[model samples]
Target: MEKAKAFLDKLTEEEHERVSRLPFKNDFKFYEDFALLGMHVDLVKPGLVSCSFKVPPRLTDGNGNLASGAIANLVDEVGAAVIYVEGLPMNVSVDMSMSYLSTAKLHDELEITSRLLGRKGGYSGTLVLIKNKTTGEVIAEGRHSLFGKPASKM
Candidate 1:
């Protein structure tokens, strides 16, 4: 974590400001939920990232269950957050495939970890896994592909 923080600290002021202005970081709802759930940026690299999200009641769906969409959103956010923190311009999700391996109830804290798998030109890919914090069970997994040039290219 300290290493990641040090990496982030090296960003120029202009770079940091550009990243902070990303839609995911600036969205009030996303920011509020990330803060409320105790989500933290743990590690980040060019195409890899890991973060954790604490499940709270407010994140549950209508069936009193943790919605798969919510899980997907968490995965996407953490994966994208990694790129943003690295001072890269925001990329758009071109495709996202998800599978719900298990169900989670309210208050079930989750750790969402993602890694950049590969990239070709302006296209990049990532893999994400959502695991149960207590039981260490994998509740969900996903793969996302993003399309966009690097921020510096813009």
Candidate 2:
């Protein structure tokens, strides 16, 4: 519509840059890698995944604490990784429940653990917990639900 087009035309140069839209043709890069930057996998096994990371300023909320959005992305990514099956497409998030218990400041080491609660057909449930490595204080907890299509017989 003309009205919508006019509204889009009114976007400022800075606004356009901040929008983060990218061409989807080829050689695309993920925009959210900063959320998982410096993460180190400490352990992995059936039904469980554990990792550690140090909070970086790029992931902060400008108040010296990790941003809530970054925490949610971690829950989604790590949570899905816990239940991943070989030769199948990646699981897609169905729902997420998050509880932010405390804040994590820059350079604070974080311990993240994800456990598979269960799986039925293509639906899976996972629990992700993030804690401060030094104090062992809970930073956030997430219950994530995901669905992945079963691999077909060739």
Candidate 3:
């Protein structure tokens, strides 16, 4: 609570502006439903980042179950946000793989955590895990490979 607020407050003005420029930042519907679901960002370092999000109804699929695509998108967004937050040039997802470990029903809050794994040349990799908030059950996992390049290249 207090610690989280302090961390957010500690961000430099430039960093704050960069994050605010994120595509989803101005989306009220996204914020009201999906983005506000226990989202947190921890900047580990340049080219390194960690982020998590709690699953919510808006992120569920037609069956009222956690949507795999939505989980993948969340992981992708967080991973990219890390690079953007570092004031580095933009990067694009070159490849991504998501594996569902379990199903989350409506109203079941789950946390998805992502971390940078490694990088080589113009390629960066990340690993993400989604877990049930209360039971610590793994609901899904993802691996992402991104192509690093200047923002102008995008």
Candidate 4:
């Protein structure tokens, strides 16, 4: 909780107000409070999701480019959101891989599209593409495999 408090302490007045207004408070607190990903879920369907957010300065690397870890966090969280929409039980990531094609600078508007590849008895695969919203340039691609607990088990 110290980290969350410390991060909150550094937020500008406007940013603090924006964070305070987040609807899904408990659900995305880590991403919003720590990762500083201003995520907004635009659409969600059974097997697909579309999200958009800006890369906050706090998420950038020393060179002022979006950090790889931040990109991975977005990919992972967005994929999990897709799984949740598909009526799957809570899941754990079994495997994940990312391919970086381009870079996004701090505050870049990013569009993330995630699609579920297929679901087997206990596992599902997902693919995601992250692109620059204005230029439509692909920045990264990600693949994730998740293992879901059975509804009965849950």
Candidate 5:
């Protein structure tokens, strides 16, 4: 366990230095821009969407597996895309529930798919699944709920 401790100590120091130099500004990046940086949209329909992404080193955790936060970000982005319309304001995430079934390693190709569950007025729900493309292993699943501006009745 000494090796693990040494590794952790080094990574912690690096992260500490990185965070200490941070200055808050409007230049902050959104989750979509960061986590979906390398994502490629494959297919899209009114209530369904599919994407292809290779697990990048920048999105991996200490164990070399895809970071859980990255998976969650993907869920939010892809889930919203399934229902997004041109010229419409983006929906805001209300709640998200996720189940991490497996881990994805660096350079592993992933297939992400999202499907609409149902909608009510201004609220919508969707389900997203992330899986390793080669091994067909399921990586994660998320249920996302979002709220948008209500449509006009006229």
Candidate 6:
């Protein structure tokens, strides 16, 4: 328990520093950390979140393309934003999968579109597409499944 508490304290400190360095803040404080990666939420409707992000050099793979993990992170985070905007309980991701269609090189401006596919009971499904804004080339696509807490817990 002591170790876990120490770890949480360290994580919180790191997140605080990261948030302080953000160029812009968003309505979601937890998601605001992504701003350091140059991600901006262009729209957030009931079950959708449209975002614009630039592939920074630091997030590149060995081949100088956007990292798959980075894309997956974007997908997962945006999907969570979609759920949050829907007045649902903050959920835990049960599964997430991504398919790489093409490569996005450093400095590429990518558009990320995420929408909640559906919500049944306490479960939610979401999909995200990452594409090059100029060419409409798909960079990656992903799906996420999450289970929200019961309403009584919210």
Q: By TM-score, is 2 or 4 better?
A: 2
Number of the top candidate by lDDT? 2
> In model 6, which runs have C-alpha deviations exceeding 4 angstroms?
1-36, 85-89, 152-154
In the order shown, the candidates' Cα RMSDs to the true structure are 12.7, 4.1, 12.6, 5.6, 7.7, 5.4
In terms of lDDT, the poorest run of 10 residues in model 5 is 23-32
Error of 3 at 31 (Å): 10
lDDT of 5: 0.89
Model 1 C-alpha lDDT per residue in residues 1-154, reported as the tens digit of each score? 9999998999999999997875454446765455345676677667667776667766688877788778878767765654553455678889889998998888777777888787777787888898988999999999888877754545
In order of appearance, the predictions have TM-scores of 0.69, 0.79, 0.64, 0.76, 0.78, 0.74
Better candidate by lDDT, 5 or 6: 5
Q: Rank the candidates by lDDT, best first.
A: 2, 5, 4, 6, 1, 3
After superposing candidate 2, which stretches have Cα over 4 Å from the reference?
1-28, 151-154
Tens-digit lDDT track for model 2 on 1-154?
9998888788899887765564232443455454565899999999999999999888899799999998998899899999988888898999999999999999999999999999888899999999999999999999999999965656
Candidates' C-alpha lDDT: 0.75, 0.90, 0.71, 0.84, 0.89, 0.82
Output the number of the TM-score-best candidate.
Answer: 2
* lDDT per residue (tens digit) for residues 1-154 in model 4: 9999998899999998998775455765754457534678898888999999888877889999999998898788787777773464578899999999999998889999999999887788999999999999999999988887645444
* Residue ranges of candidate 5 with Cα displaced over 4 Å: 1-31
Off by over 4 Å in 3: 1-38, 42-52, 150-154
lDDT of 5 at 75: 92
lDDT string for model 3 (12-126, tens) is 9999999776546354555433545566664456655555455666778899987877777777776665555345667889998888889888777666666778766677788
- Over the stretch 1-154, how does candidate 6's per-residue lDDT look in tens digits? 9997786577677787985675554754644454335788799788888989888877788999988888878887887778773354579899999999999998889999998899887788999999999899999999999898645444
lDDT against true structure, model 1: 0.75
Would you list the clashing residue pairs of candidate 2? none
Candidate 4 global lDDT: 0.84
Q: Name the TM-score of candidate 5.
A: 0.78
lDDT of 5 by residue, 32-92 (tens): 4556777898998889999999998879999999999989989998999997866778899
Prediction 2 global C-alpha lDDT: 0.90
Error of 3 at 50 (Å): 4.3
